[model samples]
Target: MEEVAVASDGRALTVGSQQLAHSLFANYPLTAAFLSFALAQTLKVLTTWYKERRWDAKRLLGSGGMPSSHSAAVSALAVAIGFHDGPGSSSFAIALVLACVVMYDAFGVRLHAGRQAEVLNQIVFELPAEHPLADTRPLREPLGHTPPQVAAGAALGLIMAYLMHVTTNLSS
Candidate 1:
C-alpha cells in the first residue's frame, strides 16, 4: 500500500509515484549524491570559463577537473548515510570505505594515468610530420584530479550532505 498526499494546488503525490521528480527526491542519499555531483561539475565549468575566458560546454561532461565529481558523489553518499544511520552503523562504515577507495583512485591511479597520457601526447607531438600517427588526435589529458581538487570535492560533499541532513530534519 502506498501513502497518498494532496497538495494545496489540488495535486496528488504518492509514495511510489512514477514521476521522475518524485522518485528522485524521495531518496535522501541519492539526492545528496546527485546534488554534489552537479555542483562539482558546474563548478568545473564555471572555473574553466573564468580562466580560459571562453565557455566550454565540454567541461560539464568531461572528467578529471578541479573538484572531482567522483569524490563529491561518494563523500556525499557516505556523509548522508552517516547522518541517516548513526556513524557507528555498518552502512556508514561501508559508505566510508567506498568513499576512501574512490578518493584514493582519483588521486593515485587516475592521476598517474593522466600524466602518462600527457607524456604520450607530447611524444606524438614530437613525431615527424610524415609519420603515420603524427596527425592523430591528442589524448585526453584532464582525466584525474590533483590532491587539492580531491580535497575540495570531499569538503564540498560533506558540506552539501550536512546541509541536506539539516534541512530534511527541519522539514520533518
Candidate 2:
C-alpha cells in the first residue's frame, strides 16, 4: 500500500485504489502480515495437537512451533510490499531485508538460545534444594524455530500474501 500523507486541509491522504476505497481492512501489506501471523500461530495449535495427540491451546500464542509466526509475518509483509510497490521499489527492498534478517535470526541465534536454555534448565534441575541459584525459574525452551519450521512459515507467508494480492486486485 502507498504511504498515507497529510493533506493541506489536515485530512489523511491516501492514493485511491479499490482496496483503499472499499475494503474494511485498508492497509493491505500490514493486513497480510497480521493475517499470516495469526494463521501460523493457529496452525501451531493444530500441529501440536496432531503430534502430541492432545489439544494445546497455549500453542496459539507460543513461540517455536511447526511454523514460525515471526517468519510468516515478516515474509508476508515483504511479499505484500513487493506486490504493492514492485520488487524494485525501496519499500519492497526494506521489507525483504527485514524478512531475511528475521528468518536468519529465528533459525540461528534464537534456536541456539533455546537450546542453551534447555541445557541450563537441566543443570538447574540437578542442583541441590539449598543451592542459591537452584530456585530460579526455568528459562523458556521454545524461543526459536527449526529450519523446517522456518521454511514452512516462509511458504505460508508467500501463499497468504499472494492470496491477499489476488483478492485485492480482483476487487479492484
**Top lDDT hit:** 2
Q: Write the per-residue lDDT of candidate 1 for residues 1-172, one digit (tens) a residue.
A: 5667766379986755455467568678889999999999999988888888888889889999888999999999999999988899998999999999999999999899999999999999999999999999998888889999999999999999999999999999
CA shift at 147, candidate 2, in angstroms? 0.8
Worst 10 contiguous positions by lDDT, candidate 2:
15-24
TM-scores of the models, in the given order? 0.85, 0.87
lDDT of 2 by residue, 69-143 (tens): 999999999999999989999899999999999999999999999999999999999999999989999999999
Best by TM-score: 2
Where does candidate 1 have its weakest 10-residue lDDT segment? 15-24
Q: Which stretches of candidate 2 lie over 4 Å from their true place?
A: 1-24
